[model samples]
Target: MNFERAIIIREKTRLEQLIERFNSKAQAKFYIERSGGDFNFYEIENEKFYESLNEVQKSISKHLKLKIIYRSFLPTYIFTENDLIVVLGQDGLVANTAKYVNGFPILGVNPDTERYDGILLKHTPSDMNNLIKEVVKGVFETKKVTMAKAELNDGQTLLAFNDFYIGADSHISSRYEIEFKGKKEKQSSSGIIVSTGAGSTGWLSSIFNMSHNIYGFNTIGENEHQSQINWEDEKLIFVVREPFLSKVTQTDIGFGVITKRQTLKIESNMPRKGIIFSDGIESDFLNFNSGSKVEIGIAEEKANLII
Candidate 1:
């Protein structure tokens, strides 16, 4: 067993964040309970998460060099080729880490299953040790998850594990020219959602559900929505959110599927406030104001998840 290192990625607990913002846990509890929230549940959830992370850390350190990293520091932290990543948080944390990493095999752990769905997290602290042993012995299996990519004309690029949002920063409509499968149209919409196969069951599912309710579009059945996606599928899906019809702007090209051979392109028409962000992280984004053109498609790189 010759693994170089293992990097454990964890997000700050709500309790820790409360202390950071309000200067103490007592103040945070007072504020939450006063506002009719469950402050007791918060404390219990935080304690379970910390204990799970601690146990996982101790087990990994016995076999390989262990490094603990916070989710906030992922962008600046350098990853090595031999590093095995173990994410201890929600499903979104795994998705967030997938974009920044190259091909490191990741083990997703749900520290507190009560607070999370753990759809992407297939392991618990009790089982993490055995998985690490298998990984180090080169006997673990992995699934390759497809990712979405957005590239601007000027060469800046962003990758998304779940989906990408192309629109304004605020509630204002986003104005852009949409081109897909050779047909193009000018549109003013709430935004555009570009999703990978792995993300089809998430944000993309909500958009389709809305369409079904509004237009009686039941082409996608309740069970089939998730059936359409495979983690390793090399394709992409996009839907325009609430496109408005104008005399000049059209709504014919509001939704479509993108593939390796096919792509979706958008040219920004808003003078200001236009932005393109991925994986729900709005703080880190690319300007998509007037004159900016972006191409959305399947990313060349894929995320590997240890099973």
Candidate 2:
């Protein structure tokens, strides 16, 4: 496959967002300093990001036609097979870009090594030139990561690179009917989190941490076992958050594994405020109100990250 263009994906720096909100850089600085915040920190972060972004553009331009796009436009952006994706930001940016690319090879570039852990960002700006060349030659390696999918009965769907949160938008309890492996129950709880193998260490691991800290929690053994899932594993793990047991509800069917052969089904009972969001981006969500049923399973498509 001959790649013809490199699409650079980025997000606005914190300083930029602040400036937009305050109407000017000076005003933004004043607001932050007045609030005891380090105004210089935001300035430095913005400077370093643009500096790294400029270096990436220069290097990629030597190999393919380069185009820059803000992360906000990703939903409406049309990508072609001839495009190579270059994502510059923290690890979350890579996760945000993966679902929209349809398995296109993504090179994650860590703009600020000091600030971000960059678990998903394997390359730096200096590595772009050589990496782009290898990708264009089709000689590069990619780690195929499994993703989770939520398909509603009405045919609406959402993909999650890390995990999907199915519950109320607010802090109130979410009421739903959950079914897995022939067992079904009606419950009221915080929500349900369905995570892919790549997402095992993220929101899913935090749940395990909480469970570990709680004494006499028998679920610690199961949490430890599920946390070791690999990124390439074609499976998903679903856990019910704080499943409350009452005379009218059951908590027996709260946790399970999802696969090609098995799936977790959920039907919302909330009259309003029910939603399903993926990868921590609540803005891009599916309305999961009453009468909406969704099947949570392993997505057929995967995220192909350039390694």
Candidate 3:
């Protein structure tokens, strides 16, 4: 594909957010210091982020037209196949941007090497010039990442690069009727998490860790082992969080694998406050209340990350 421009996606720094809330840099600093926080850290972080962003702009602009957009504007941004996505921030920013890209090639750049793990950021600012050239020439390589989808009966839908959380918005139990492989059960639990292969080591692995320690055994044997689901895997894993067992609710159908052949179906039993959020972004969610039903499955679209 011939690329015409690069769209840089970014998020506001912590200091910037503080300034917005307190109305000024001085006020933000005073509020943080008064609370016994290190105000200097926020300033330094903001400085480094912009410094890296400047480097990225200088390099990529040499090959294509450049435009910068904040994360808040992603939902309404008009993206085309001719645009290359350049995400510069923490790794979560990459996940946050993937669903909106519609399979466009995304180059993840890690701005703060000291602060972020950069699990999805494979390139640094120095690599931008060469990488942009390759992308424009259609010679760049991309790692295909699978995603999960939640489609509501009302025609609304949500996508997740890592995982999807279906449950209540608060700490209260989520009541839902779940069906898989033709078996059905009513469940009352913390919620349900449907994770893609790229997210296996994230929130999903933590659950396995807690279970293995509590049970004193692993899936294979007494020796511990962490399961790995590849980024390209077509399957999904769903685990119920703290399912409650009683006369009306059961915990038997708490865990399973979801595939193209077998999709997971759910119906909300809660009167209100039920939600379905993706990639840990609560603001971007679908209402899942009573009389609402959803189908969970592997998404037809995948995140194409430029590796």
Candidate 4:
């Protein structure tokens, strides 16, 4: 292969996580059983995922230089520009890895087709040879996935591949002042979800689904897939989940589109437990307390996924 190395990113399987917590497979099973969970399903899922991973590893070994990495180490890991990234897991794994890799050409490989409906994972292990051949010849097709950037006035920033959740860390309401397109409001809701085209089908889509599925909701002339934006779409959408209407708070500026020109600005009124987490990674979140301001917009950096 022309590339120096391919970084195969993966997540810890359910079984692995269970074993890590309990220290042994038998202990994990016992714990699951005691907790009224299905241990058999866990064992089967782990076995299938490992088997698929083995097949993928064997196929990728012949054509490319590969470096295997777990998802947990991604934040501290340094990725070179010349390296090719291959994430061997479900769509969430692909989204998690995309934010860290900058613009490296990432190939998403589905380890178990039956287990995961990986919309982001476009290739199977059997297709590895052709995919590698095209990449080495510099003839690969790429999707420039749009990403959402959350920047604090303090200079801290985080990129979201699927979407961004800006709100409270607890069950209580998130308090914030949201301004967009010269319109502003004091909102207290569950949170604000800023979604990119790439993320529309992810956490973003579920929001629409939940709203659309409401008994009397009507999406009359709108194409249902309109919320499922293309990967390269330049625009972004933000929704304030469950905005509470009261004397002090207004829902007028609750939802809108964030484009290349205009942006969404949020001022946090929460004293603590306020966070901005991307793609559902709760641990890797930014603290958004009182006096914190975040600007949400289209990120300059895009994810290049080899299709």
TM-score of each: 0.95, 0.97, 0.97, 0.94
Q: Each candidate: RMSD to true structure?
A: 1.9, 1.6, 1.4, 1.9
What is residue 231's positional error in candidate 2, in angstroms?
Answer: 0.6
lDDT (tens digit, per residue) of candidate 1 on 112-200 = 87778998999999997777788888888889999988999999999999999998889998999999988999999999998888788
How do all the candidates rank in terms of TM-score, highest first? 3, 2, 1, 4
CA lDDT, every model vs. true structure: 0.88, 0.92, 0.93, 0.87
User: Model 2: runs farther than 4 Å from truth?
Assistant: 216-226
TM-score result, candidate 4: 0.94
Worst 10 residues of 4 by lDDT: 215-224
After superposition, the stretches of candidate 1 with alpha carbons farther than 4 Å from their true spots are 217-227
Report the lDDT tens digits of candidate 3 across residue range 24-90. 9999999999999999999999999999999999998899998999999999998999998999999
Model 2 agreement with the true structure over 144-248: per-residue lDDT tens digits: 999999999999999999999999999999999999999899999999999888888999999877777785456456545446589998889899999999999
Number of clashes recorded per candidate = 0, 0, 0, 0
RMSD of 4: 1.9
lDDT of 2 at 158: 92
**Better lDDT candidate (1, 2):** 2
Report the CA-based lDDT of candidate 4 relative to the real structure: 0.87
